[model samples]
Target chain A: MAADNDTISGYTAAFEGFEASLNGGARSPLHARRREAIAHLQEHGLPTARFEAWRHTNPAPLANGCFPPVVTAGKLSAEAIQPFVVSGIDGPLLVFADGQFVPGLSRVGDLPDGVQVHSLSAADSETAAIITANLAALALGAEHGFAALNTAFVRDGAVVTIHAGCTMDVPVQILHVSTGQAGLTTPRTLVVAAAGSRASVVETFASTTAGAGVLTSSVAEIVVGAGAVVEHARIHLHGADSLHAGTMHVTEEQDARFTAHTFCLAGRILREDVHTVLRGEHIESTLNGLSLPLGDDHVDNYTTIEHVAPDCSSHELYKGVVGGRAHNVFRGKIHVHQAAQRTDAYQSNQNLLMSDDAEINSKPQLEIYADDVKCSHGSTTGQLDPDALFYLQARGVGLQQARGVLTRAFAGELVDRLQHEGLRTHVERLVSARLDAVLADQGGAR
Target chain B: MLKITNLHATVDGTEILKGINLEVAPGEIHAIMGPNGSGKSTLAQVLAGHDAFTVTEGSVRYENEDLLDMAPEDRARKGVFLAFQYPVEIPGVNSAYFLRTGLNEVRKARGEEEIDAYDFLALIREKMALVEMDESFLKRSVNEGFSGGEKKRHEVLQMAVLEPRLAILDETDSGLDIDALRVVAHGVNQLHTPQNSAIVVTHYQRLLEYIVPDFVHVLMDGRIVRSGGKELALQLEDKGYDWIREETAAAAAATQPAGA
Candidate 1:
């Protein structure tokens, strides 16, 4: 217990170190919220195996090990980050290295009249007001240790604001590159889509090193106003040995629609928490996720969809391909409140186990308090269909290649949902390449 | 192009095919007719190198190569094709893409030039018309949500695209309507050449009217009881299979030793 306290204090000390460097914005409301967030972490400390959310994934690395905040941004050339960029996207490209904004490598020169893409640290007055008002509003600091640490440690992150009646022709790409620094980097992103607006945002987390033990605790908050449509994709392309914990909070208003696509492709230990709330009537929320974990990697996804109003609908589909001796966990909860009548919710979690030792733990829950609501949840974990495999092979495809093709099709189901051609193609390519590596590591021809 | 001698196979230790012998030559279509549970499907599966069946005692020669020793894909690459009775529905794999990959693999194995997507689309369009398949079927997942007749037609569509030397049709006419049957048979007949051969396995003689096999063999109790020209199929259709079963019993009784 004492060692745990010491590690918690280590983070507190890092917070203090960051607070001391703050000169002008220290007195701002966002900074004050940061102070309160650290105080909460100091009081509660980190969660353990006893915690419900932390039961499947062991947080000892973040609970016991001390990863001081990345004080300075790591220097990376434009060429180094080129591979992570999605080609053919005409929208602004916001780049971050080691959790700090890299303006030299970013392309923010865009005039979408009402669209704003800039760093949180360099936000304009109006943007700052929106950020301070809505940043921690959805994702509160008392949720967990990672959320608190993200609020306390983030100095620079991406802030996208879409005005009312506006539309973004191309998706805004936000790429966070880790320099493999042996520290904790907390990247914060806030997206506010005003009423009658529409846009797509793609956030990718990647590492520059093949095997670097860096911890990234990211927090993102999205506000979809009335009648707005927002599409968001979170992609993880971390190193083989990197660790990631991300939380995204989205609130949809009346008649608004929000779709979230999460692709966890790499990383040794990955945890993703997607919390969404339908705050008004006739709102729709869709959550889609795909995780391909190879080797001994561990990936856990916890999603919660809360229906706070009547006539709201939510759909969730999460798929995983577990290879090697990897482990995957998916726990989804769809809660319909008493006042929310006529609420419709559906959740499904499907996994394909590639190796004998690979394992998956899936739990889909529906807590419906309203009597007039309709809800259904199902979870299935299975191997590649032998009939499908033989059918492909009988067509002259090699055994190993047949397995690869089937596995790709399993993951490609979600990738095809991406409406953007360039992003969809890019994700397809990434998923294919990673799938090949995973199948190859399985020692082909099994 | 294909020869099987004294072939015996089993599924889960239960013998299905026992002492089967047959020979197929180029440009010839031999229809194997049998009642249910007579191992008609089992023989087709075994020839395609399906691992579920254990070939207890058999020697199958395809183009003078030991067909049993090769993997299912290897046999396919060596110009052997089996049109399954029940075509599998593979979701998320587009029909066009699946056909292209399969064709490329066959071409690569034959040391022929691989066809690009554009040319393959053109070739597939021509073949699709042979089976009356709509253009939308090409974009759908392979055989997924296809009607029973449509599945049969897709099998023939694959036969047209793959262009194998030896094609095995395992009950391809089952569950198909008259129009669909004619279309499927037309596709198979068009793909048939003097250099290629086909084995049309069916339980009914209705398909033989369209396919017009060079020879027809009646399979019963896992062995070829009788073999004759296409007229033999008509005889079975008229007299039913019980007559042949009775004849087989009579022949066995005559071969038995006198009272001992």
Candidate 2:
């Protein structure tokens, strides 16, 4: 126990060093905010195993060894990262390589009046002031050490603002790519849609390194103004040896609507935290996610939706399939405040374990303080039925193919939630590729 | 050709098939009729190598090979097929893909090259016609949401494609209607050949009218108590099973006097 305490103290000291390095830079409003966040993290230190949220996800990986901090001095070429772009979205594109803005790779066409799409460092005075007012306002706090650390070293991310009553037909794509081995990078994004504005954004993270230890900590803050509509999708397909931690914070104004989808497929250890706050009446929010992990990979998704106003609605569904020795954890919580009467919230998490050695831990919780709220939560975990397997075998299908078919069907339910045809096809291909790899590995082992 | 000699099987510590003996030669169709719990289905399951049934004492020889020693899948690879009474519903696995995989697996096990996608599609189109099944059925999940008659027809389609050396229809006609029974029987009859055999397990003789078995056997208490030609099925169907039960009891008593 004494040794454990010393190890934790060492990690805190290293984080203090990281904070000092960031504050030593020039002073801008963004820089000032980063300095303040580092000071806050220094006072709080890293979370321990005793923390309920960090119980299943141990932070020893981050604290085990030294990882050199990476910074990008100039923009990356668009031709070098063209293959990583998602096709068919016409809106302005923001590209980031190694957690720094890559202006050369971006293609921003003519935008509507009062619509701004720029890097955090390149933002003008007015835009920077708006960002300062809301940056890191919804950080996960000391309970989540990665979120705090991300805030401490946060350099350049994307910031978009749509003025009142403006509607954009195109979707803004934020592409974040990481290169090299054992490099740690944090990409931060802040989105604000003014009253009666509407927009859609797609955020994708990919790794160019084959077998590198890349740790990416990302945070995206969304504010939907009154009567505004926002649809956001976040996709994570990092390298198998990478560590990914992401948090999404959404705030809804009166009569505003927000929908977010998080898809996780490839990564070594991934922890996703989604927190949504309904601050106005008649607001709507939807949170959906699908995760497929194979071999010894592990994924954990924690989502919370808070209803702080009356007549608000929120729905969340997360599904996962685990094979080989993989493990998955899903924790979803729906909270209704004391005065949040007439709040309707539904939360569910389901998992399918393909192998006996695989494990899935799911906990769906509802904490309601209002008497008139309707909130419910449920979770289930199971494997393919033997009877179904035999039925397929008797039909002449080999055992392995039969199992793959069933597992795909189990995860297909979540893929069907994607309304966009192209996105759905892309996600389906990713899920199928993951399944094929799992099958190939098992075949090799046998 | 298939032969079963003194086959005794147990399920869950209780004996279900005690000293059962029968023989089915190629080009012949045999119908096994019995009352409920008479072990007719057990024989089909045993031949298919279902793991739940323990063959405590028996020998199942298929084409001179020891069938009892093979795995269920191995039995399939060796040309033995069982049409389940309750076909399992496997969602997410398309019917066409399932059949193609099964066909290619058996082909590969026999040291033959696999069929390409174009050839597979052609083969499936030819086989689907035997049961009057639509091409659209190939896109749906295997047996998922399929009606009882459709599932039975699907089974026949599989049997038609695999062309097993010995096929066991385990109460395949139980839930099917008259028309479905005729279609299923027609599909089975079309596959009959001097190199192939079939065993039809049914509780009613109605299915026999279409299949027209070469030999009919009555199974009771886990053993065959009577054997005759196709006419016996009609007799049993008209008179019911009570008379056969009484005759079997009297015959047993006569064979061993009062004190033996």
Candidate 3:
């Protein structure tokens, strides 16, 4: 039964069909890498909940044929994707529908000098060779099944490269929409921040219909050059029945700075893996996440920060609010190598369970091999205080509004931490909308 | 006015108020004095509709309606209030915003329009003086990181703003120094009127000196053993609760039904 249920067989078949359609040798090494990824999936099926890292998120629905793979994307009108655009960005907005770039629907303004921003599928021969050289360089192995699969089927995604000492004043947004065909959307991104350059990128994912189920497998690889600064934010608002799993691999050179903010509000099953390597001295990395799940949905966040050089620092905080029967999982790991002395790392995860059936599991771990390193990790999970609720109720605020006040307060901490005003406001609005949806669901259930 | 008849309440299945009865008319300040573990705070909590305490047998009537049947928020809307012994700390909720929400909700319940931010600012600024609270307190989180005295004063501030008809102050003076006691008591005195009544629950005589009670009742072992006029407080302060306990016990034993 297990062998029969092996879902990768379906994907293997799809790969053969896809390979036959592509121009021979026109794809070159990327096509070769694609073949290798699908072959691994055939040998070893998709990851199960039994895996230590996949303990909380179960991809069984996809494997069991509940959500089959999508070989072709559905045709969606421009009206379907008008809602997911990030309104504050003026430079460039790359639009993708089920892993295929839609240029007619996208809007690209004038960009700064020495900044190259375009879709990977639109890469020229010389640019394609450069991308092929760097492709799979950051995400190397098939151990991460979703990332490998994403690589195998990556049709189009944002590819950005900034010249040395250049800075972009405006943000570049990459918007991906899964139009609810019960299929798959794989969008792979690569960003190279040249030395002494500064840039910011925002990625958003969502589906058109409210409860339509789909599978989205995405991977993003980033390289921060020496003395460069890069800020990245990923906001996922997939439908409640969809499954979203993405991996991010970032490597920082000496004296570079990198900050990543992840916001997940919708999805039946959502999991994010973030890995950052501090390779040189004076490198700093920040990872912040906010997740609010409703009903029986599940949201999982896993982050790992490895310090490979002396005088490096990392700070991470992940907060969650689980309403109804939702479940939330967060695990953060900080590893300091033997030669990475003077390393400073701190991690904290706080969660609030809004209903009796809600569940939150948090684990913060530190593995330090250096004697002079300072590593601290803490995790807390608790329900909203009854006393606080009563205090509000006693003053004439109704029970429901009081609950909303407390819930908003719990999410406000994360919303306020966003240093970018536009991003903060955008995220705050999403939080409010999410809370309203949760309240509506609860009201209906009650 | 408020009336309690044959009141019996419990916490965690343990009886706390055993067949206690009390009444307060308009313009009256009734004091409930008892030693530790005498259920003084429990009574205050029960009157305010705290769900932790179960009313095994009792009826509480206010304005000729059954007060015990109402929810906590409903009771608040009906002009019933309790100044908590330890005011809860709710972080990230601005004090001014919370206060306005409370006032506006009560107004909405009474068919009154909500107060605008401009009017609310002026109203809260005027009420802040009653409790001797700084204008800065209005911007901070509700009672978060507040000093003990500030929390108590904030309660008085709420009472002043809500203008409850039946206010129950539970241990409001337990942790206050003399100056804070005077400020809080002064605020209470300023808000008192012939149209409203109050029930003051305390352990010491110092608070009674400022907010004088019209009647004093002594509670022991979950029952009110004695009731009297204002002199009762002075007498209890000098003699303590032992004499009252002994007198009640003797009377109970002497009146015991003929058994065996």
Candidate 4:
């Protein structure tokens, strides 16, 4: 209890200093929101194992760590971020180092009419107006500790808006690279897709080094307007010793179509929560995720799809490949309100444990108030099928190669879901390379 | 090319193959006919190096090497193949990719250069023709959602692609429609050569009519009670297995000591 209080007080003191650093912007509504968040932390403290949501995923390492906010942005070159950027997309590129946008390392091509992309920390007056109105609105009311923490320490992020009837042919890439420094970084992103607009956004969170002990708390709020189509992909490639807690809140109006893909590949301890609400009728939501956790890494994913209007549909599939002694947790909830009749929601989670010590906990919750709803969820966790392995071996494939082939196939199922050819190939190659390393470490199908 | 002496195996501590003896020479097709639980599939599985059965007492010499001492993959690399009785469904593994990987591995083990995708595709097109399989199957998952006949045909297709020295067909005709059985048997016959041998395990004489074997053996009580030419299969088909069971019983009684 004393240790917990010490950590909370540490954040409180950091917030006081953070507020003072805002200078002329200290009394702004955004800063006021930040203050409210810190006070909430002071009153609530950090979430612990006692919290039902944090039962499977422990937060002591992230909550009690000495991860002070990063005082200065890290210097990076264009070459440093070139490998992480999604190619074959002509849209704008936004690169952020230590939560601050690096303009020299980013490129914004000719924007389509009605499409605007800006850095939150250096937004124009017009962009700032939009940011101020939508910034912590969707995330904070969830009463999540990490969301609150992100709001409290938030500074620089990406702000994108697609006006009515505009369609962005290419996806916008928002790349956040950590320098593996020993400090905390908060990245906040807000995207507003107006009515009848279509856009795709890819967000990547990565580290420059493999095992740096940095802590990152990020929040992204997406407001999908009526009849809009928005596709989002969040890829995490943090270092082995880093801690990451990210939340993405999305709200869909009538006839909106939204799809989100999450790829969790690295991090010592990582948690991602994606909550979406269907506010009107005939909305469609899809969430797909894949996580490959090796070594002693821990990853937790939580998702909620709230159907508030009738005739809304949602589909979710999250798969995990756990190697070494890694652990993974997946909790998916589908809530249909009383007025949300004829809701169709489907959820499935599949996990493959490569090592005997690897573990996975998957829970699917469906709460429906309307009777005329179709909801189904299923989860399966198992090792490589011995029969399948033997069948491959009998075809003259070596045992190691057989395991590699099967494991890749299991993980590739989700990679193939990506419609973007370049991103899919990039992700596939990375996943295949990672699986190869992990399989080699396991000493070829031991 | 193969010899089994006093072969005995057990599954879960219950003996399945009891003192079975068989031999196969190159270019010969030997058909083993038997009733249910007569150790036909057991022999096939043991020869293919399935780990489910424990070889209790046996010396299996394949091309002058100890067959039991090698792993399943090693056996396969040594030109041994078994058409499975129940083909496994491997979801998410493309059939073409699986076949290519399998062929490359076999080629690698034999110190042969791996075939590139183009050449492999050409080769696969020819083999698929042998089994009358459509090109779309190459894009589908391996044996997933395949019909019973399609699965059996796929096994034969693999046999054509791998081109093993010793091919053991375990109930390859089961669950296959008449036309599918004819197509599969025809594919197997086309793949057979004077340098390779096949041990066809079956319960009926119908498949024997298509791929006529040189030798036919009747297995009962885990032992070969009778052996003859292909005409023996016809005799069993006419008289059924009851006559063989009765004859074996009488012979066993005669072997007992008088007034023991």
Chain A TM-score per candidate?
0.97, 0.89, 0.93, 0.96
Which lDDT tens digits does candidate 3 get at residues B209-245? 9999999999888888899988999999999989998
Error of 4 at A226 (Å): 1.6
Instruction: Please say which candidate is ahead in TM-score: 3 or 4.
Output: 4
Off-target runs (Cα >4 Å) in candidate 4 are A139-143, A440-446
Residue A10 of model 1 has an lDDT of 86
**Docking quality tier of candidate 4?**
medium
Assess candidate 2 and give its lDDT: 0.82
Which stretches in model 1 have alpha-carbon errors above 4 Å? A139-143, A443-446
Q: After best superposition, candidate 2 residue B163: deviation in angstroms?
A: 4.5
Q: Sort candidate 2 into its docking category.
A: acceptable
In the predicted model 3, the residue pairs found to clash are none
- Put down candidate 4 lDDT per residue, A175-215, tens digits, no spaces: 98898777889988899999999999899998887636688
Worst 10 residues of 2 chain B by lDDT: B89-98
Poorest lDDT segment (10 consecutive residues) of candidate 4 chain A: A437-446
Lowest lDDT sum, 10 consecutive residues, model 4 chain B, at B100-109
Among all windows of 10 consecutive residues in model 3 chain B, the one with the lowest summed lDDT is B251-260
Clashes of 1: 0
Where's the lowest-lDDT run of ten residues in candidate 1 chain A? Answer: A437-446
Candidate 4 TM-score versus the reference = 0.97
User: What would the TM-scores of all predictions be?
Assistant: 0.98, 0.83, 0.90, 0.97
Q: State in Å the error of residue A18, model 3.
A: 3.2
Most accurate candidate by TM-score? 1
